[model samples]
Target chain A: MEPVDNRAVVDLLGALAYAELTAFDRLAEDARLAPTLAGRAALARMAAAEIAHHSRLTDRIADLGIDPATAMAPFVSALDAFHNSTRPSTWLEGLVKAYVGDGLAADFYREIAAFLPPADRALVEEVLDDTGHSDFAVREVRAAVSANRKLVGRLSLWARRLVGEAMSESQAVIAEHDRLAELIVAGTGDLGGVAQLIDRITSAHTDRMKTLGLNP
Target chain B: MEPVDNRAVVDLLGALAYAELTAFDRLAEDARLAPTLAGRAALARMAAAEIAHHSRLTDRIADLGIDPATAMAPFVSALDAFHNSTRPSTWLEGLVKAYVGDGLAADFYREIAAFLPPADRALVEEVLDDTGHSDFAVREVRAAVSANRKLVGRLSLWARRLVGEAMSESQAVIAEHDRLAELIVAGTGDLGGVAQLIDRITSAHTDRMKTLGLNP
Candidate 1:
């Protein structure tokens, strides 16, 4: 793989770190929409895990001697736009957004982990795995839709909206960060390789949908 | 101790649980005002721990077959009012408020734990101690004020506002929940004992203020 410049890496890491911080804040607020105490706590734990990810990424940014906020400044609008546009309005909607939305982020980080230098690679790797709270979301989402059966149609629709908004923001980031895109593309060699990456993300998302008994 | 009604225990647990949930939300929001990423993450983790406490308290509430929200409802307005009225306008105010305010809750919970049934007592005992995060806040507050010297005067004044607002809301809660008050007075033995509980809370606040380089 071709060597990426430190500036590009810093920008990437800062954007990722800010994303984690905003995710933590957004998901923590979403926890309020939970129908049950168990559900609220489950989402809260997920929010908390984002802070851990935020910490690791922020530490790396600081070690590089860049102002973390300055590094993060460029992406703030896009991230905030993503969350504001896709804010969930119901308990079921919140769970689906968290499960489906964060699942996508976990996938993206795993893919990008391979492109990073060793120290940065390890940070990405550390963030790829899920906290146990996904099961809490799964349990609740499954119960809600499965009990009514017809509610699957509604939730599946909600899942699609989450994906759409996430993809929209991701495209905005890609357009904004050409250097970062070059790194991902350089690692894979071509559009087909990018297609394969998308395929994997799509498949994992499908598996999640099936787990919740929603039509993929 | 006379047998306390299970319903009363559920009410207390639910109130504490929701309080933790909202505290998590508020603190996560407040963390953004921190001057450094490390500082922000520290506050976020402290917020996260409150969510964990919420989880434990909520589980106990569910075990009692109560709808957690219903059990939490009676105290929601009063608690919300307290936070809304005492919203921290700056990073220092936020930190000092978190330190003094949560210190009060932890202290009160310690006193109220005595009035609870065994299981509930254990829950309160577990939730009361946040030694690491409290220590982190104490150190940060002290360092900030010590470095500037002038800031100490400002924060001490902020602490006074926090206590005054808190006391007003707390009195409302006490007046609203006769059973809870009965349980507290029963456990403590008299109005004098209640006064002593307040004294202990105040003494702890003084120690914390001293640690933060503020006047008691």
Candidate 2:
């Protein structure tokens, strides 16, 4: 096996750490949109889970001798732009975004984790592990979508936009970080392998949307 | 010992639960003001701690055969009003609010918890336990005030306003809930007991402000 690049590892962890941090911020903000206290608490719980993941990622980055803040700084703008662009306007939209948007990012990271060294891969997998709150999102979104078929159209459009914004920001991040891009290409065995990885992520995203009773 | 009044217990727990919920929301929102990712994560962790306490409080409320949401509904407006009026405009202010404002509330609750049944008292004490993040707030606020002596006057004023608003809203809440008010009065042995309780909380608040290098 080829040796892994340390800078690439830092970049990947940095990006992932920032992603979790912003996920916490957005989900917590979106909780206020919940119509009920119970609903709000559920969303807040999901946001808390993101913070825990973020702390772990930052801890691992620190163990690698990088200042976690410095490492996370590079990706802050891209992730923030993605979240800012995809802000959910309502409780149901927030639920769907948490389910679909985070699921897509997790899937992509899992795909890339395969190319990392064992330790980094393990950390990635641990951080990406579902917080078990997806069931709440899936249950809530499916119930709402089923009750009002009209929501199907709007939420479906929202989900697609979320994916589009995510992918655009992700590509920009990769483009700016050559080590990260090289790592992805090398892990895939070639550019074709990267294409296959994208295909896998897209397919999983479709399944996730379907599970949420939304169009892919 | 007089049997604990179920209505009063419910009211107290409800108020505390809603306070936790809003604390989670406000702290998470304030985290965006943090100057660095590490500082943001620290505040986020504090916010997450509030959610955990909220979950426990809600669970305890449910155990008493009340819907957690129903229990929390009554205090929502009061708690929300307090947070809305006391929104922090900067990172240092947010840290001070979390430290001083929450410390004041916790001191008040701990005083009242003494009059409750063992189980209810235990729950109150547990939820009010500091999340150990106060050190972070103290360290940061002190360092900032020392570097910029001008911050002391503004932040001291902020701290006073926080307590003033807190006391005003708290009086409103207690006035509206006869049973909760009775609980506090009885626990203190009379109306004077209530005043003494306020005195204790006030003294603690002053000490907290001093610790933060701000005048009370």
Candidate 3:
């Protein structure tokens, strides 16, 4: 593994920051899909955390002497496309998306955080890890699953689709961000090594599915 | 001013909390109407702060052994009616709603906060106040008004309608919750005193309008 530079780390942080911002917006929109007021408020609270994370990352990007919007631009389309292609059609679907989809994304982010420089890495770690967020999602998904065992099949399928879309976007981000790819290479070596990193993401995702009592 | 009891303070705090939660949800939804990413994000950030306020109030309600949902229920219809009656039609109108409408609402909450028990009053004073939020709304409105002088007239009309609806709802909440009304009465005394309070609120609002370069 080679050593990563400041620019790649900054770009990576920028992408994560904008991702959080956009997620907050999208999840807030999706909260309307919730079946109950409690559900709606829960999702809105989660969305709020995303924006808070975005604010922290934005501050870091500014400290790096980079315009936040400029640094965030490259991943906008990939992130938007990920969301657009996977709009949930129902309350259950929305919950599933928030639970299953975000878990996988966070796992990938957790892996990438290790590749960042110490200060940048801490920011990535801080922003990407949302324990309050994940617990809520997991609990919501579990309650729904327990309430109606029949929901498992459809939810599992939805979860799979969300995972697939996320994987596609993750690959697209990698392809475009040669600098980021370079950073990963510095930390973990060759392209094949990077591919293994995704396999690990997939394994963690399966663990999440099992945690939700879904088939791995 | 009359002293406030725990139940009355709880009612007021719960109402404010739910108002913040609902505002966060609606503003996040309305953010989609923004033509630019920056505009959407600004609204999203504002919405996030509302949730942070909501969480604090929710915790306090729980501490008082009240169901947050039950405490929130009475104000929901009035809040919904107010927002529904004053929906913005343009991006500038949205900014005006955020600036003028939220400014008025925050002012009202601050006034009411003074009528509560000491702990609740301090919580209300501390938790709901965010200078960052008001500054963003002010900046957005100022930019819009400065960019197009004609926007002032339409937004002024919108502001009047928003205030009217808010007034109607405020009266409804007062009528429905006698204990809460009594707390306000106790804090400021009878009809004449309350009228003076209203006058103060109105004067402050007028000053806010002038600051926005809108006609009072």
Candidate 4:
């Protein structure tokens, strides 16, 4: 195992905390797009779960003596930009964003979790609890695609765009934060290793899309 | 004591359940209007707590052999209408609404809970937990009102609008459901009794508004 960089660990956790907070915000907003009260409540529950995860991450950051806001500040723009770019215009789009977009980001962070020191790794892993988000998302998205075949195409495109924006933001973070990038390479070993990590995230994301009957 | 109307209890619970669900939705929407991430996250947490309460109420409704959706369905429109009518046009309004508006509803339900049969009463009391929503709201709204004295007029108007819309909907619910209304009158014993109850609610609300330096 490569030597750990404490600064990078803090950076990673900060990014994850802000991601969960923003995800909570986005999902809560998207819950409004739900077609029925039951559907809306279900989405809201998922949104709540994100906040639960966020509190854990934020508390963990505080426990580490980092001013959570300072650590979280740099990544807020990148995360907020991704959401702004992929604003869902419909209930179905919101569903896809909550399910697919969140899963992709989760996968990306889970990869980095492996590189984390044990205490921090545990915090990362714990905060990533899905609380049935993927199951609900998959079930709902698949049902929609089954009901309207054309949605598979449009939603597939939306899923692709979400990933495009997310990846660009991910690249921006990597470019700006050398320590975090180094942690990734250290976890995977080198440049090819880093490429493999991307491949892994893409593969998982594609699998999730396919499960929802959307194109990879 | 008035004989418990099982159907009315279910109706009351259903309405409460849906009210909590929509409150969750409205708060989540209002969270986006927050001026800072911390404030946004704070509102989101409150929103999540509403959904948490909604779940408990829905579960208790099922325990009474009512379909949770069927229970929640009737109140959806009234609650949704109230939210639509009182949509906060600014962040301060959102803060004020969460405080005064929800406190009003909670107080009203606290009145109803007193009339409920034991199991239902416990459920209602438990779900209505403020979890310090009023405190968070009061502190935030007071700070804003203090910083901008002119905000007092706009916010006081918003608070009154919120309560007005809420009261009309409250009347509609009572009118539409005789059993529930009967329970209320039965619990308090007649017109003056109901009047006194309203007075109590108004008093609490007035104290809250004064604390925030807004007109009741």
| Best by the lDDT measure | 2
The DockQ-based CAPRI class assigned to model 2 is: high
Q: RMSDs, each prediction?
A: 3.9, 1.1, 2.0, 1.7
Give a tens-digit lDDT track for model 3, residues A100-157.
7877777777777788778888888888776476677778788889999988887888
Q: Write the per-residue lDDT of candidate 4 for residues A1-216, one digit (tens) a residue.
A: 867988888899889988988887787788888887778888889888888887788788788888888789989889989889999999889989888888888888889999888888888888786787668778888888999899989999998999899889999999999998888887899999988988888888888888889889
Residue-level lDDT tens digits of model 3 in B106-187: 8788887887767888998887676476676677787888898997897888889888888989998899999878877777
* CAPRI tier of model 3: medium
Model 4 interface Cα RMSD in Å: 1.1
Q: Can you write out model 2's per-residue Cα lDDT over B11-112, one digit (the tens) per residue?
A: 889989999999999999999999987899999999999999999999999999999888888898888899989999999989989999999999988998
> Where does model 4 exceed 4 Å of error?
none
lDDT of 1 at A94: 84
For residues B1-216, what per-residue lDDT tens digits would candidate 4 score against the true structure?
967889888888898888888888788888888887778878889988999998888888888898899987878788888988888888889888888888889899989889888878888888887798668788888888889899999889888888899999989978988888888899998989999999999999998889889998
Count steric clashes of candidate 4: 0
Error of 2 at A77 (Å): 1.2
Q: What is the TM-score of chain A in candidate 1?
A: 0.95
lDDT of 4 at A145: 90
Best by TM-score: 2
Better of 3 and 4 by DockQ: 4
Candidate order by decreasing TM-score: 2, 4, 3, 1
Q: Which residue pairs clash within candidate 2?
A: none
What tens digits encode model 1's per-residue C-alpha lDDT throughout A110-156? Answer: 78667778888888777657777788889888888868988899889
The residue-level lDDT of candidate 2 at B5 comes to: 88
Q: Write the per-residue lDDT of candidate 1 for residues B1-216, one digit (tens) a residue.
A: 688877768767877887898799789888888887567778888898888788777777778888777788888888889889888899888899888889887888778887887778988889867748877788888888979999988999989988898889888898888888887888888999999999998999898888788988
